[model samples]
Target: MIRDLEDEILGCTRCSRLIDYIRKVAIEKKPKYRNYQYWGKPLPGFGDPNAWLLIVGLAPAAHGGNRTGRVFTGDMSGERVYRALYEIGLSSSPKSESRYDLVELKGVYLTNAVKCAPPKNKPNKEEIGSCSYFLKKEIESLPKLKVILTLGRIAFDTTTNILGIDGKFSHMAIYSTNRLTVVASYHPSQQNFVSGRLTWGNWISIFYKIKTLYTSHNA
Candidate 1:
C-alpha cells in the first residue's frame, strides 16, 4: 500500500509548471551529471512505515532530489541530515547519494512539503496547496508518528497549517500537544550552512532533542 502511494505520487502531474520544468532539466542534464539518468518526478517520503520521527522538509532541490528521485538525496542538505541521523543511530548510513545507496532509516521518515522540485527552490502558495494532499496522505500513513520535525520556516508553517496548530517557529522551538509534538529547526541548505546560520552543532542539537523525545515516548 505504501509503495502504491509512492507510485501515485511519482506519477502525479497536478502542477503543470513543475512537471514541465523538471522534465526540461532532466533532458538537459547538468554538465557534471550528463551521463546520469534523472528521475524527474515527484518524490515520495522514505523511511520506516511505523516511524516515530516524521521529518518535513521544504521541497526537493532542483538538481538534487529531482535527479535522484529520493527526497533529500544527492544534495549537501541531505548529507548534513543523513550524517546527523547516522551519528545518532537513526540511519544505517551517513550518506544518501541515491535511492539504491543502501542507506536505511531506522525510526525516522523524511518527506517534503512539495514533492516536486520547484523553480528557484520556491513553491508558490497555489503549488503548495496542490501538493498538500500528498503530505496529508503521507502523514496519515505513518501510524506511529509522534514527532514532526520540520526543517525551515516553510516546512514548519506548512505542517502546522495541516495539523491546525498555531506556534512560533524558531531554530529549537518545540510545540507539544496531547497527541504529538512539533519541533522546528533551520534547514541545512547551502545558504544556511555557508552563512553560518545553521552550523553542524545546531543541526545535531535538533536531532538530539528528537532522539530524546522519541526514546522517552517509546519507553
Candidate 2:
C-alpha cells in the first residue's frame, strides 16, 4: 500500500504550474546531459518503509534530483547527506550518484517538502500547500516513524505544519513530544556549504545527536 502511494506521488500533477515548469526543464537539457533522459516528474520519497528516521529536504535540485529521478541523488547536497548517514551506519553508500547506484538506508527515509523541482529552487506558498498532501500521506504511511530531521527552514516549517506542531526553526533546534522528535538542521546547499553556514563538523554533529536521541527513545 505504501509503495502504491509512492507511485501515486510520482504521477501527481495537482499543481499545474509545477508540471509545466518540470516539463520545460526536461526539454531544456543541460549541455553535459544533453543526451540523457530526465525523469521530469514528481519525486517520491526514498528509503526504508519501516524507517524510524525521516529526513525531509526542501525540494529536488533542478538538475540533480530532477535529472536523476531520485531525491537527493546526483548532487552535492546528496553527497553531504549520504556521507553523514553512511558514517552513522544508516546508509549503504557515502555517495548517491543515481537511482540505480545501489545506495540503501538501514532505518532512514529521505524525502522533500515539495516533490517537484520548482523554478529557481523556490516554490510559492500555494505550490507548497498542494504538495503537502502527499507529504502528509507519506508520513502517516510510516507507522514506525519516530524522528523527523528537517533540512532548511522551508522543510522544517512544512513538516511542522503537516504534523500540526507549532514549532520554531533553527539549526539544531529540537521539538519533542507526541511520540516523535523533530530536529531542524541547515540545508546542505552549495551556498550554505560554500559560505560555511553549514560546516562539515556541524552537519556530522547533528547526525550524532540524532543517533543518541533516537537510541534513547527506542531503547
Candidate 3:
C-alpha cells in the first residue's frame, strides 16, 4: 500500500508550474552546485514505516530536497532536523547531506505538504490543495501514527486542513485530531535560526516533547 502510494507520488505531474520550475532549476544549476546533477523531480516521503510520529514540512527546497532527492536533505533546515532527531535517539546520524547517506529514522516518518519544490519556496492554494491528496493518503497508510509534528505555519495549516481540523498555527502549540495529536513549531529555516525566532534549544526541545508524547501514548 505504501509502496504504491510512493510510486504514484514520485510520478506525479499535477502541477505544471512546479514541474517546470524544478526542471529549469536543475538545468540552470546554482553557481555553487553547478557540477551536481539535481534530482529534479517529485520527492517521496520516507522513514520508519512503523513510526507513531509523522513530521511534516512545507515542501522540498529547490536546491535541497529537489537536488538531493530526499526531503530536508542538503539544507540548513535539514541540518537542524536530523541533528535534533539524532540527539533524541530517533535518527542514526546528526546530519543528512545526501539521499545515499546512512541516516535512518527509528520511530518517525518525514514528509511535506507538497511533494515538489515550488518557485520562491511558496506553493499556491490550488497547488497545496492538490498535493494534500497524496499527503492524506500517506497519513492513512501509517497505521501507527499517533502524533504529527508540523514545522512552520504553512505545514501546520496544510496538515490540519487535510485532517479536516480547524486551528491557528502557533509555535510550540499542541492540538488533537480524532486519531492524532498535532504539534506545531516554527520552521527551522535559515531566517528563523539566524534571527533567533527558532533557537537550537527550542528546536531540540520540540523533538524532546514529541519523544515524550509518543512514549507516553505507547505506555
Q: Over the stretch 150-199, how does candidate 1's per-residue lDDT look in tens digits?
A: 99998998888888888889988988777689999999999999999988
Q: What is residue 24's positional error in candidate 2, in angstroms?
A: 1.3
Query: Model 3, range 89-141, lDDT digits (tens) per residue?
Result: 88999898888888899888899999999999999999999999998998999
User: Which segments of model 1 are wrong by more than 4 Å?
Assistant: none
User: Residue 89 error for model 1, in Å?
Assistant: 0.5
Q: Candidate 1 vs candidate 3: which has greater lDDT? A: 3
Residue range 1-219, candidate 2, lDDT tens digits: 458888899889998988998888899978999987888999998999999999999889888899999989978998899999999999988888888778889999999999999999999999999998888888889889899999999999999998889899999999987778999999999999999998899999999999998998978
Q: Which stretches of candidate 2 lie over 4 Å from their true place?
A: none
Local distance difference test scores for all models: 0.88, 0.91, 0.91
lDDT of 1 at 188: 92
* Candidate 2 residue-pair clash tally: 0
Could you tell me the lDDT of residue 68 within candidate 2?
A: 95
